[model samples]
Target: MTAPIYVPFQHCDALRTLAVPYGCGIDTVGVDPASAAPAGIPEPTLTPGRYLQEIRSAIRAMRALHDLLPPTA
Candidate 1:
């Protein structure tokens, strides 16, 4: 993985990697789903190359659209 450019901010006392440059968006999720990575369960893993490619693809798609999804009324 590329070196993290942003120092991780403590969230609930856990250090989480920052995806600033590549983060397309963020949404709240259930606690169980969020714990998978921080807990190191390792059931699902992505090779760095493939992961970066997917991230680039996602950012491109989002940029092409030119707007994020609207909030629910």
Candidate 2:
């Protein structure tokens, strides 16, 4: 993965297509070590620790929810 290039988080979605021509092809974006999301794109202004905690919590909830469902015969 390539190194990150910081950009405003507000422009995150909009800048993606626009940046492609500037040589920011999809592969050039790096994975964020903290959030495990794409890098270069600005991290959300929210607290990283809290955000990650919430993500993990949500995943656990989803797994638990799936487990609660009846298994296919």
For candidate 1, the 10 contiguous residues with the lowest summed lDDT are 5-14
Model 1 lDDT on a 0 to 1 scale: 0.37
Clashing pairs in 2: none
Model 2 quality (TM-score) = 0.36
TM-scores, one per candidate? 0.30, 0.36
User: Total clashing residue pairs per candidate?
Assistant: 0, 0
| RMSD in order of candidates | 12.4, 12.7
TM-score for candidate 1, please give it.
0.30
lDDT string for model 1 (1-73, tens) is 1112111212211211223435434432333333434575553444688567656655555453333334567
Candidate 2 Cα misplacement greater than 4 A, ranges: 1-45
- For candidate 2, lDDT tens digit of each residue in 1-73? 4223232221343234444335443433545545665567664555778657656655655565456556899
